[model samples]
Target chain A: MARVYNWQLGREMSYWYPESRPKKQFAAVFDTNKCIACQTCTLACKTTWTSGKGQEYMLFNNVETKPYGSYPLAYDVKLLNMIEAGKWSGKTYEGQTIFESAPAGERVMGWRPEQVDYSYPNTGEDDCSGQVDHGALMQLPHMNWFFYLARICNHCTYPACLASCPRGSIYKRPEDGIVLVDQGRCRGYQECVRGCPYKKVFFNPMTGTSEKCIACFPKIEQGLQPQCFVNCIGKIRMAGFLNTPDKARADNPLDYLVHIKKVALPLFPQYGLEPNVYYIPPVHVPASFNRQLFGPGADAAVETYKSARKDMDLAGLLCLFGCSESLMTRWKRTGDIVVGMDDSGTQLVRVPISEPVHVRTSFDPVQKLVRINCP
Target chain B: MRRRKLIVLPALVVLLFVAGCKKAPVQTTEVIAVAAAQLPSSPTDAAWDNVPEYLAKLIPQDLVEPRLAQASTPEVRVQAITNGTDVAFRLRWLDSEQNDTAKPGSFVDACAVQVPTKLMPNPPAPQMGEAGGGVQIVYWRADWQAWVNGREDNIKSIYPNAEVTHYPFQAQSLEKGSPEQKEMAKRYAPADAVGNRRQSPRQSPVESLLAEGPGTLASNPAVAVKGSGVRTQDGWAVMMVRPLPEGLAPKKRTSVAFAVWQGSNKEGGARKMRSGWAPLAVEEKKP
Candidate 1:
């Protein structure tokens, strides 16, 4: 076994392949609170990449309502149940992850989902717990608590898809840490599909191969953000390169959110894959529930996000979300506004310190007519 | 455990022969390519009766199993004949379960033959070949054969009750003859749409492929090999015929390898039963 540092796990972990450190790792932060389940990101990804014949059932990027919705219908729940059946302590997993717990002669412990499993992509859409009684105006903070979770391939530091492929067809690019399946090499084993805990990898029976998100590498290479990131209507996504935790600088929005302020935490960090995508846990949800999804850092991340407005740097970083077509490499507070800039130092966007107010119109029953007035 | 017995039993037999200080007759099975009086019209023709049979022991591919394990057809009786123009192989394997259909998670029974591009000092790795060493492969699929024979009970036949209310590229669609239909077909089934029209009987179920190591196998695109299979009470008898490549001279000694996949065992890719290299020699007709 080869050992490598997993910043998310805050320790080193073992892997079958030798450690391959990319020049810059692809990273993103999604604020679950701001997502509205519009699925613009999902459509953007589908139209741009996965609109092929065997890809009819695939959604490289999907927006599912959390605690209820799943694409392969409870893919996460099944894996989580398996992990729970094993040993786990606090933030550290004592037993094996899906990759480590593979049976003898197998590369990873995986399950092949039947066709019926994929037949329903959104089996439990918008299902929330603790519903309020009908005809009741009593609004409780805990009632009707569900959020949209926009998911894509994590492009993990230790991708189970890459490790599980017996033919060594799946690989992570050394430049950006984007995991991809080599079409020519893949033999449609579906092992990658089976081994992926997130079920992001898909098998194309037509071509007899497996495929996954390429991270919009073509667009990224042209200095533009991924289609999903740029087209997100909720503006909850921020894509950039993650700096080493120790070397994190305030100028980098990703660094500030993940390393300095520690406001973004990886989803299921206990899986030990050091997944690159981070999430700012929803503040309204219970801490224990958030902890189950984002690990022990949930409470701290929520607190940091709640207090973000008081800190100019944190506030500016928050404003950087979905602000530009290009990947934001740095940001700064200029006067009363925050400006995000790309690697070339070109300003991509500027947001005011406080949102500007607008006038509105209202109608009164006595007048029986529409009225407009400045507030 | 079966693999251990396969290795240990052979070694023990060899040890006993040596310990007895007796001259043991070495039994060798050779596939002699005969210049047929006349080539058999079909694989199941009476001409095949004249050919001698060779027993090949099939071993589990434990190198990549469960992660790669599936039910494997343990042994196959092979017979080969050549008309100096085309070479045909009749492979009979015992598989009580005849699995021919494929579904989302299910597999189809298949078999393949591998021969090196040139005779090597040491045979190419049985698991397709080593880097820089090229191998020619003829792969036969039971599913394709069923389709070629126009057998009902294909995928659509198996799921008889499946109601498809809407399909994007249905024959009735406005884009039926347009490029969009071609694109959709290509995405769904490249083999069907990409100029490779499926022909019954004439178009063999076997595919000709070339490989230069693991993960380097590519379809030859020539459709050079022809094959058919029938399921009997005991198992399947498959016949594959292909003209020997020009590189192999007539009467020259060479070798070929065989691999079998049992769909019932869920065997595919690198998970299947296979044999090491076996001797192959072709004979020229006496004037």
Candidate 2:
């Protein structure tokens, strides 16, 4: 076994392969507050890939209502319950991960889902916690709260799918940290499906093989964002390459949201895979509930996002979201506007720190004159 | 140190036994030639009642098993006879539980007989074969038999409460030659495309497969073999029949291997109970 540092967990973890970092890791941050549960991202991913036979049930990108909904039903909840039952604790999770919890001869701890478990992809949709009275007025802290969570393959540093493949068919690309399953080498064992806690890997019964999101490597190679990232109707997603934790730059939008401002946090950091996708927690929900979904940083992240207007750098970085097709490697505050630059130092997008507004004109019927109205 | 040596010695012997050692005891059978009129057509034929039985020991595939465990069906009885046209072999193994269905996360009971295509200096690797070794296998699956016999149930039959109002592919108005219809048809079994409708009775459940090496197993489209299996109170009685391929002289000494899968144990792929190559001597007819 070899040990590698997981920045999300803030500790070292064991992996079967030697420590080898990718040149640049595919990363993204989703602002959950801005999502409207439109599912355009899901459709974009479905039409681009996973439209073949046996992939009818696969949704590479799914927007699910948190505290209620999940694609494979209670996939995350079941695994999270297992971890909690196993007494997972500590800031760095001193307890066993799924890899370390395997039985004597097994390579990983996994459970094969029943066929019935996959019958329904969207169960308990939009079911929120708490009830509301007929005449009660709602305030900042509402009685019932739910948020849409847009999820895609995290392309983790330590992937469970890569570890559980006995035939060594699954591999992580060194160029961009994209995990992929080699179709020729795979024998349709479905071990990766069983081992993945997020349940992202899907088995193609027609071809008798397993497949998952490729991170749109074909598009990424040409400096284009993935379909899910570019086609998001909510404009809540930002895709970019994340630097290693030790080498993170403050100018990078991903780094600014995830590290410097610390307004975005990884989901289930206790899983110990160091997932690349980060989330800005919804502010309306209770801190404990947010903490259960995201890690201990959820409370702090929500607080930072609530006060983002006062932080000019944070406000400037937020302007870069949904800006361009090419990933922004650097950004700067120029006067009252933020300029996003690609790796070649080409300005891809320019947005003001605060968007400009225009007043509407009201028509006066009797005088047949237009009157300008201001807020 | 002396006590540790004694403990290690027995384990080494067991390991060698499981490793397909030639010194391990093997049941040898002599194939007798019978008149075409007197040859038995089925495994339960009365003619097979008088044949000599050879007992072969089946060992667990420790190389791929989840743990190093003993074989569930340790011993199997075998007998063989041949007519001028075809050769038939009967394999009887003890498995009290009948596992004949395949579900998600579950496997079906199966058995296979492997013979090399050509003579070699050393027999091919018992785990399929090495490249260029050219191993031909006759595989029998219980689930396939159930499917052919109309005893297998579809998804709706398994989950009765599932609400499936309509399937778009089943629509009659859709043009059969349209691309949308063709794409929808891919969801059905490959047999459906060729008009071999499901739940139809067939002559045999066994399929002919060939492998040049591990992970190279493929179904032989030639349809050169046929077999059937019957489940009894004690175990399964399976009989496989095929034409004796060229290259093997009638009286020459050759060998064949046997593998059995107990579905209840979740055995498939490389995880199975198998016997090392056993000597097979076909006797010539008397003038």
Candidate 3:
């Protein structure tokens, strides 16, 4: 094992291979507070990629209700149990990562779920953390709490799937840091499926190989976001590139949300994969539970997210989510409008700070139709 | 002196007991290879019954990464025969379940017979040979055997519950069996599109592979290797046929290795039970 630095753990740790980051890391920020779990993003990804035979059960992008819901039934809780929860002192994690805690002959500390584990993809769909009593009313810090967690492959800096492949078939693309299974070289070992803690990589029975989310590379190469991000009904997703902390650019929206504002945090940062997909923790969830799910900065992330309106630059970047299909490499706040710019300084889109609302009459005179609903 | 004897006596006894308890090295016996007019094509052919069976003890492969600990299969009864032009090997192992599908969370029962390309004074290591001393492998897979035995090789056959709403390869707009449709279908099955032998349709139950070390196994030129595997009451009886190794003639000795994988135990690749190189003494005449 080679010792490499994991910024998420705030320390250097052991990895199977040496640290060789991509020229540009494909990353995204998902605002958990805005996700409604409608699964439009799920369907969008499904129809676009995994509509084949062996991938019948694959959901490259899925939304699960946290605290009681999970795809593959408790994927996080199972791994977390094996690795055991570790302590975090401020920004530094004082714990054994999945790699550091691996068993004698194993590469990564993980458990492979049985086929039956994937039988129920929507288990505990809308279940809350606690039951509601009769005639219960909403209040601050209510007993019942649940949040939607939309997930895709994190495309980690040190991908467990890439590390665990004995055939050396799985590789991280040097161009975009997209971890992929070399379909031609893979012998259907399914080691990646077992090694990945998040259970993103899936075994394709028909092709006799493992497959995962490609991060919509074709669309990305054409300067567009992924299907799931573009089709998100809740507008909670924004896909862009993220740089390391030392090289974090303030103009980059992903960097602004992840490094500068510190509202978006990587999931299970203690795992030490340095997953690129960041999340803005749900504001209403308890800090303890959120911390366990998102890492030590969950409480601070929630605070910053709640007060996003005060920061025009931050709020402007958040408004650009799902605003356009094209990828915005950079963003800036100009007056009351936020301009999304490409890498070549081309403006892709512009969104106002506040949406304009014009009240319509109850009855429409032009169409001669009665309006039952008022907007 | 008396105290010393008392202490040393018990210590000697403990040492002897521990040595006895440890597993002894498997006897690498020289097994007889029966001569035949033509090598038997079937595992259960009457010709195989005439040959002596050599029980090769299997040990977990601990030489590389992803090693196995005490593989489920402990031993495989091996029988070899030569017809000058070709050599055939029959391996029978006890397994309760006949696992023949390679799917999600599933593995296939497999076995391989490996021989050095040239018979040398000192043969290569049994762990898939060493650097220059390459080993030619005739690998037999239960799934491949099933495919050659007329089992359908399609998604519907493997997964009855599969709901394929749309597959560009099977799109109604594309004419059936057209080159354009095949080109479009290649996108869904990347492994098959890129010509992965395991994913492509095959008529042979065994694949000819060459290996010079761990993780160096790859396809070799076709050498007219044939195989047949039959499910017996207790386990599988597989017959593998291949061209005779170099420097092996009638009334001669060569080296060979055997490996077995129990699919139910999730064994494959480096995680399977293997036997060290064993001597194979070929007979001059038919038994």
| Number of the top lDDT candidate | 3
Q: Report the error of model 1 at residue A170, Å.
A: 2.4
Q: Mind giving the per-residue lDDT tens digits that candidate 2 earns over A213-244?
A: 88888999988889998898778999888887
DockQ order of candidates, top first:
3, 1, 2
Tens digits of per-residue lDDT, candidate 2, B141-192, equal 7766766566523343333454444445557877877887866655333233
lDDT of 1 by residue, A140-182 (tens): 3434677778899998989988887767888888899889887
Give iRMSD, candidate 2. Answer: 6.8
Candidate 1: tens digits of C-alpha lDDT, residues B7-106: 9999999899899983432233876666676566655677776677777788867654333454467777787777777788878888878776555466
Instruction: For model 2, name the residue pairs that clash.
Output: none
Candidate 3: tens digits of C-alpha lDDT, residues A190-284: 78888899999888876778889999999998999999999999999999999999999999999999999999999988888999999999999
Error of 1 at A99 (Å): 3.4
Q: Residue B149 of candidate 3: its Cα lDDT? A: 76
lDDT: which is higher, 1 or 2?
Answer: 1
Error of 3 at A298 (Å): 0.8
Error of 2 at A130 (Å): 5.9
